[model samples]
Target chain A: MPPRPNQCSQLSGDDYAESGRRAPAVQIDDVVVEKGRVRILDGISFTIPAGSITGLLGPSGSGKTTLMRTIVGVQAVRSGTVNVLGRTAGSAALRSSVGYVTQAPSVYGDLTVRENANYFATVLGRGRAEAERAIADVNLTHEADRLVGRMSGGQRSRASLACALLAKPELLVLDEPTVGQDPVLRRELWSQFRALADAGTTVLVSSHVMDEAARCDRLLLVRDGALLAEGTPAALCAAARTNDFEDVFLRLIDAADQKAAA
Target chain B: MLLVVPSSLLTLVYSMFHNQPGRFDHIGLTLLAVFPFLTMFLITSVSMLRERTSGTLERLFTLPIGKLDLIVGYATAFSGAAILQAGIAGLVAYQLLGLDTAGSPALVVIIALSTAILGVACGLLCSAFARTEFQAVQFLPVVVLPQLLLCGLFVPIDGMATWLGHVADVLPLTHAVSALDAVGSSSDPTAAMWQDLGIVLAFAVGALAAGAATLRRRAA
Candidate 1:
């Protein structure tokens, strides 16, 4: 069972998960992000432990994507620090150690799958064999020679993932990675996630999928840039005294809304 | 695929001045005659415009690569065909025109390459300021066309509208044409060519800095 936010805090950071360091792989301390004068991430703070799988669960417009971009150094932190891999997100070494798979597939439409992979490898300093292995890992080897534009949506997502994994990053951030994937493929991908965590790679995934939220080692429930609740799916359910993660997710969202209104 | 821009430049030069234009005067004047610089402008600016239009600019910002690498990579990649076009133009000029060739042929090739770089730099600066490919293209007549019209190519530099002539004197290509004209005539190489090279380098560096700033703003 997952611990309540406060309860989880009590469990010495190391005891919370298999993650090695007490310091987080990603740490956001009082981050406030804005886009064109509109606040997107409003003084939010959280720490994702190394080697743990942390799922960011939120309703739409909850600033999930904004937060993820901040962690990857693409979005500026209006105020506060974002530390990843023991350095600021903007640090070159940290950039190399962190791989990001954005919501949109970043593959070039005109390039073949293999060409796309090769381009990434060349730019990211990955070896050919490693790139091929990543393709194989994502089960994209069969589609390697096909143009990215012609591939199915799910295959494009898989190719995007393979490209992200090519760098063999220690901290991987995936935003709604399984969006267009089939149920079986989702299951297979989560299994791969588990393997990645087992190998000591910290993973941060953002998703609205409730069942998927239940599978993550921990969850950060957010709404309107504020942390609504933080715990494992089971712990949240226990706190709400319900077995359903969806119900727990909803109740917390409602509670946060009510509090904000008051 | 990306070779279209350079090939067009070569074709424009060939179509305009039929029968090989020999001698530096004929080749240089002929190149200056057609609007080849416009093609170079489009080639250098279009790629950056495409990146922004396709949402790939944001994607590129998320990568680990340095800003310098991005600038240099795109510039170097586009330079290959630009050099090829210059070579073909020179060869065609040699065969078609009966101008006597003097001095190291390699020096001419170097000058041609430097000129291409100047053109690319100008295009890059335009791309830096433009939000879309169309906006960049609009700059063609206002920015590049004047360089051709007033840079002492067709009309003597002294004969143009006084202010236009002054503006043309400051143009980067004006110095380049001065150098080429001198080289073609096998006369004393004017200091104007060195000045043109210096000005082109300045423009290239300024454009690169502007590009880096734009990229930084986007990332932020």
Candidate 2:
């Protein structure tokens, strides 16, 4: 994938003002999610601007996946609302406009990667050419005809990601998409995401790795089912008095712990 | 996949029951009573279980498809396969093995088709309750064995205990078995046979709806 500069940081004040006239791609207000009497997401709210890569950074079991599911409209929310692409999240109308990839590889094991893409395109009422384009976008064209079950783990996940990209969605929500990828493949994917965001697709990606957060145009630091902070990476570093995201995360966690105790 | 099963089953039956009196009708009854239905059931249940365990089912729910699309798609595909299976199985029993029936042999194939659809529906419903493929296989005994034993194939429901007879009256496969028996014994499709056929189809529809109801879009 060709390298694309992070669009969120490159925008001038007036250029951002021009895009701000329109609504954000995603808007969440006081969203609370509970599963089996345990609160998974406490009252949390955030908005993702169009044409930006927004990273959702948090440790395991910190509710990042749950938040992504809520935005994609598969998880039941106990209270509050998640709005996506100007419609209620998970609405039928939003179905064609939003693409979501779960943490695991969800495509058929028996079908080849290209067949899975074609199948999802049919499901999304999209054409075959677009599915092929998605395959090329993920750099899976060489492995397109191989059965996903026979492919490597990273290849299988990329096949699933290609299926999600079939819709060419306005909003994309991915849950830990690079969890097991090699460094080179991970860099390629990030650049692909950046290219998409530069072309005005809102990308929401969740990851526990702090290094990945530096690649995002905006970062939402989450811990223990609550939003700790939302700002640019530079701004967050300034506040935490550290350039390293790992240290910034530790400092933020300590501050939040102290605030909760007080 | 469709043609291979019936020929092998025919060979097995022919090898075992050579020159028996009324062998033709007995094999005909067996064709209608069990074969297509069981095969379809296993096929649907295992495939659906794979879908669930592999996370593809949950992923599909997030896509643009409706619940009916998934349910009906499975039903139609499996039912279509079962119809082909029924044809091959029926052709072997009636033409090659000389299995005889009083009613039009076409009616026997039709009844088998309907019963196989019921199998598909029940399989679909069972998969919703099963979390693993092993658990899905286990449901076969709970859901099908009771019906097979009490459906009046080996011993008539009338000969069984009063409560057992009443339970047979409620099981869908009972009607399917009785309808096949009616076609085997009488030249015309009897009123009781029509009623039994109707009951079998209604139960298939109900089971399919139950399967759909059990599937939730916002699954936790």
Top DockQ hit:
2
lDDT of 1 by residue, A1-262 (tens): 7763323233222334546445678888999888887888888888888788889999899899888888888787789888888888867676667888878887787788888888888888778898899899888898899998899989988888898888888999899999989988898999898789878888999998877876688889888887788876567777777656678787887876787799
Could you give the C-alpha RMSD of every candidate to the true structure, in order shown? 4.7, 3.2
Writing each residue's lDDT as its tens digit, candidate 2 over A1-262 gives: 5422322233333323444556799999999998998888999999988878889998789899999989988888999989898889889888888888989899999999999999999999889999999999888999999999999889989999999988888999898899889989999999999888778888999988778887877889988788999887877877888767788788998989999999
- TM-score of every model versus the real structure: 0.86, 0.94
lDDT of 1 by residue, B87-111 (tens): 6655655555333444344445556
**Each prediction's number of clashing residue pairs:** 5, 0
Note the DockQ of each predicted structure.
Answer: 0.34, 0.74
The superposed Cα distance between candidate 1 and the true structure at residue B76, in angstroms, equals 1.8
Checking candidate 2 for backbone clashes, the offending pairs are: none
Worst 10 residues of 2 chain A by lDDT: A3-12
